[model samples]
Target: MIQVLRPARFTELTGEDEDIPRPPLSQTRTAQQSRRRKQKKQLERRWRHSAVVAALTPAQAAAVATTHADATSALDLLTFLSRERSHEYSPDTFATLALRLVEARRCPADVGRARVHMIRACRTPLEMTRAMDDLDTLARRGPRMDLMAYGALLVQLNTLGMIDVTRARQLRQASTVHPPILVFLATGLVGSQVRWGSGAPLPQGIDLFFLSHPILSTLASSDRLLPRSPAHARHLFDGMPRRKKRQSAPPVSIADRIGTLPDSLLHHVLSFLPVQAVVRTCVLARRWRHLWRSTTSLRIVGLDDNYYVDVEELRKFVDHFLILRERTDLDLVEIKFNEFCEEDQPYVKTWVRFALMCKVRRLTFHVRGSQYLYLDPHLVSRHLRTLDLDGVGLPETFLDFGSCPVLEDLKISHCIINACRILSHSLKHLSIYCCHNEFNCRIHVSTPCLVSLKLDHFIGRTPLLENMALLESADVYLSDYCKDVCLNYDSGVLCGSNNNACQNCVPIEDDCSRECVLLGGISNAKYLKLLPGSKTFVFTRDLKHCPTFIKLKTLLLNEYWCEAPDLDPLACILKNSPVLEKLTLQLFSEGPNHKVEIKGRYSSMERPSAISEHLNIVEVKCSVVDERILKVLKFLSALNICFIF
Candidate 1:
């Protein structure tokens, strides 16, 4: 919707620190083409971004305003999306740029349509044509359009003319915050919509056409502007600002009974909606016409968002929903494509081989960038069980999960790793977020009947979690770049804690780390989190070969495991967790709060057999609830351990 912004040079006109020194490094190509044609005609005759594009938005000042009476005399809205003629937004340029960013009280930018005029995020049918008033003649004057707001600029505001806006543009909503919720939300109109809970404020000149849109942005400047009586809406409903919590007294209308369910329970509730709302629920009838081809979940959200687009009718409705659905057996097929290039990789490998030839069983493929999906070496998934991926990349013949025999849950986010062993033996819940191992070796993860392991934020070489002894919940996060962390510390390399005077990490062999088995493959986990790091040393150099978790019970640690001033990796995981029970400890999370000096609180004479038999509960969030929280309550004898914070 931009109509002009020309800058072929002159450093693309306006600001972004480009160090001001280019006339192609000047050595006289005719004095650098006459000093770049006299600084491109003095920045095109001293530029004029019409008050910096209306001070950044009003739909970029109606895209360089061609004096809009509903725009479009386009003298080049920045080449209307450069280089190739793709300016195709018509429905009268999207209702004329949504009627000039919905007629003025500015909106358009980053919209979830401004949460339909926020009153603690209002919801429901409420879209009265993005409001400007005269709501279909005040919904035929019954309950005076009940505080007009079935949302969209308070519903239709008289097709954007705003019933002839008078002198409004002054000191507009100075310091926003509105919704003295239009006279206590009432009903009367449902088609253009209006079940919004009310509070008041529209006492006519139509309240200057609801202070010119963007959901009544705090209607100020009043001199009793118009509506002479009705006690100026009970004086803006006793000046509402949560006038007794939106003061509603009429919302009982529940008889829809899920439409007396049938059509296989409404095709199992339109198979948890999405493929464009289950093909717009076949216009909601004729038994939802084959109920979105026997909906067993196909959730396709082509997420390309910028605003007002088409994606070639979602690539011709996903090539006509892969030649019109009904090829049975799906249970889940989520797809999120955002421009997926390489000429759409053979139509996204024929839509992931038609969701693994319909024996789908949970598959979410999120793409946009870093795309790569070369599977099928042994992927004959016998009705696979959950495989979520994002960003993308995966090759070593899809990591020898030996033909997915009922593959058991795998999630990978922000991926890229081209395999070096993700050996799953009928995997059981594995999640790896922010993935990266393109190859710097050490990426082994033999999921030997794993049960819930989530390695978050990984980078290169620190995967190695070989055993999993039937783990039960692990959420590891090891990033201080993580190539076995201790990253070149004094270029030495023997990380046996801060005083082998701890050199960088990795090559320590018998003191463990032959690829430091990521916490000895979750040490038969019973819930662990091990999250934080500001240059982690893989669980403090795997505390020399510390493995007696003995089915640990809920530990969460951070301040990177008592980071070094000798707490001894939180006293070697509280003397190797002998039935530890809930011990949170996030520790000064967002820095600057000192006193970590618990100094083994007078040298631990007694107390660790999980703080004397089964550590009870210890919580601690912290940022500064200081005395270092009473020296971590005498350094973890935590006052008979129920010291939550």
Candidate 2:
């Protein structure tokens, strides 16, 4: 015992002292270890329990968990168990999870994850059907279900290629759901199959199944659902009451249903029909007698061979429409009168006066027959925002647009305007087409708010822009008489032809000779157009009087003679336009053989060295490319320029 225990191998230490002391375990430590093991086992069991419960009936627990704390704890337990173990969950449970996830605040990410899980869980058609049925149930329970979820389930069914249409019809019949939702589901299913290019034929007896659903039956009765055949139509109507059966019958003619619709829908439907059909419908019933008068739009054409409306009858129709229009407070009106006679001028004036009094927003007066149109200045509507007149003769004083203060758009086509003076402050858009008279064609526009102006004339002087501070766009196609028309600016005169040439040309006092003086040039316009004609305009140093057009971006020189004289006038413009971005020159090289030579008399005049820096792009459209034109290209290219033909 006194000797220390010698360190020895087991074989060598046979029968040696085995006297090693062992420490006893502490009670507190053993108790703590036992408690921790018990806690871990309990946690694991609770997690497994939650997973099984969630897999079986997620919706039941979801309905119970109203508080945020309860929902979060339940979700956390479910998530832990799902990650720890893989298990088969019921389709109803998955659907419930999808619904709960969607309803959670700020849970789009969770909802997306749940949707993927649910979609993956749908291995069989029955599972998919059950999921859809659960969603349908939830939709009926006052909870707002997502339309896209229904769409997804339908897509799954479609992918299977052969859906149990009978079962679907049965579910549709049993469920208390909206018809639109059911239609959406059905159409979505059909559409998805169509997308996959599948030949999945619709099931038989589907009609009978649909007929069992009240909503489907109602929709079928209303003719919203497709009828399989004429016989199907009869079958769909057979079960309806007599009153509903009569209501479901198709209308024989447009007149038959005109009075049945509410006024708003009736007017909308009538708006699509032609004026003759509208008139015929009006004669169908007493309810439709004054309905046309309340229409915001009206069109009457002489093409109808059956109706022979004389000037008096036309006047009476307009009077009746206007009287009813006043009673109903209609805003928009369009009248196309094909019957025009000298006797109808007073009647026309009366109608125009009534329209003005009613403050019609849109008024279109298209006179077909030959007649002298007299528009009294006092009768012109102040509230007329748009005025379009075509195919009539207007008085020389007709274009005195002083009364139309609120006029925003004005279009006159194939009509005569004796004096083209526009003095409206609110005039924004103006267009004149195919007017072949220039007796007093002096345009005096004082609109500070003018935005767009188009003038297409065969005989007239180019109108002057006296006060166009807000003028943004202008297109002018001048006739021979407008060759030397002058444009007066606040700063200087923009003469189209040489001022000295005007002295040699006949004076303005001579009616016939006054047309010879050509005036050109528009200053400070954003868009400018120069059209081709039988007019020779020379641009000398006086051409510098043209406006600088600091904001000019688009310039079009259309159908111009290719002579050097015409090109010389344009040089001054090209030099002055510093901010010009797009320049389009269209030349009519081949025309009536009025051989004119462009000697470039102003060739000796120095070209602006800074022009190449200012102009960015130039486009020339000509019938033939010649050497002189090549020289122009060379000149532009010499300045490191790019040209397009």
Q: Model 1 over residues 480-573: C-alpha lDDT tens digits?
A: 6766665434322234434554344535554335444677888888998887455666665566788888888888777666545546678787
Report the C-alpha lDDT of model 2 over 319-377, residue by residue, as the tens digit. Answer: 44443232333355555655666767776776665566556778777766555465664
- Which candidate gets the maximum TM-score versus the true structure? 2
* C-alpha-based local distance difference test score of model 2: 0.53
Residues forming the 10-long window of minimal summed lDDT in candidate 1? 187-196
**Which one wins on lDDT?**
1
**For candidate 1, what is the lDDT?**
0.55
RMSDs, each prediction? 27.8, 26.4
In candidate 1, stretches whose alpha carbon ends up further than 4 angstroms from where it belongs are 1-160, 163-261, 269-290, 293-297, 301-313, 316-333, 338-365, 368-389, 392-412, 415-430, 433-452, 460-472, 475-481, 486-537, 540-645
The reply for model 2, stretches above 4 Å from the true place, is: 1-262, 272-276, 282-290, 303-326, 393-398, 436-441, 481-522, 534-544, 559-562, 589-608, 612-614
Supply candidate 1's per-residue lDDT for 18.
46
